[model samples]
Target: MPPYPYLATDYDGAAAHAAIFMVQWKREGDSLARYLVRIGEMTESLKIIQQALEGVPGGPYEYFEMRRFEGLKDPEWNGFEYRFISKKPSPTFELSKEELYMRVEAPKGELVIFL
Candidate 1:
């Protein structure tokens, strides 16, 4: 379920809240992307956020989010990629984990914003 802020007693309020989430999400995401790149760290957060919003493997809404923080060091990425998929969506629990390609390739972008 979406957060409580998205709940509304009327259609107008619901639309207003949806708009609010869009605006606030962009504003906050930009600011956070900047902050994460501060202190000389090579950053590419916009891409990551896009990756999360796009969802993973199961397609679009299948996965709820994908995130990474400062950890590990590989030539491609100096962090850990977290792909979060909700089991409730497809409910294909019978399949083995290997049957599902859990990891997802992230999006690419070059935008920055900071608080």
Candidate 2:
């Protein structure tokens, strides 16, 4: 996978979010196999979320499909407030896998539990 470019936001301003951590982890592993494995795990978690949302009591499940290619390719920086918090590159940026996993999974698991 190529380095994905995006302005990552922190939810709690505690650490750089998952994507940033993935990019760095991809670099740290520095191998195709490791990179694929890491991404596979992340993708699987996201898939679990998608599966859990299937055929729910809503018009449609929309979280995973919220962003389109055009939006990311040319994102509009209109100063609109984002749902997620922004984490600037800083000395205190935490890049631990445990934190990243918790950030991504805990919320989803909570939602799934509620469902």
Best by TM-score: 2
lDDT, candidate 1, at 17: 24
- TM-scores of the models, in the order given: 0.16, 0.23
For every candidate in turn, the CA RMSD to the true structure comes to 18.0, 19.0
What digit string (tens of lDDT, one per residue) describes model 1 on residues 9-98?
A: 465421122211221123355767666545223233343345445542343543232233233343233223221322122222255555
Which clashing pairs does model 1 show?
Answer: none
> Each candidate: what lDDT?
0.33, 0.41
Worst 10 residues of 2 by lDDT: 81-90
Candidate 2, residues 1-115, lDDT tens digits: the string is: 5555334354533232333212334444557868787777687556544544552345565554244322543233212222343222222235665444122235434221111
Candidate 1 wrongly placed segments (more than 4 Å):
1-67, 79-98, 102-115
lDDT measured at residue 11 in model 2 versus the true structure, 0 to 100: 50
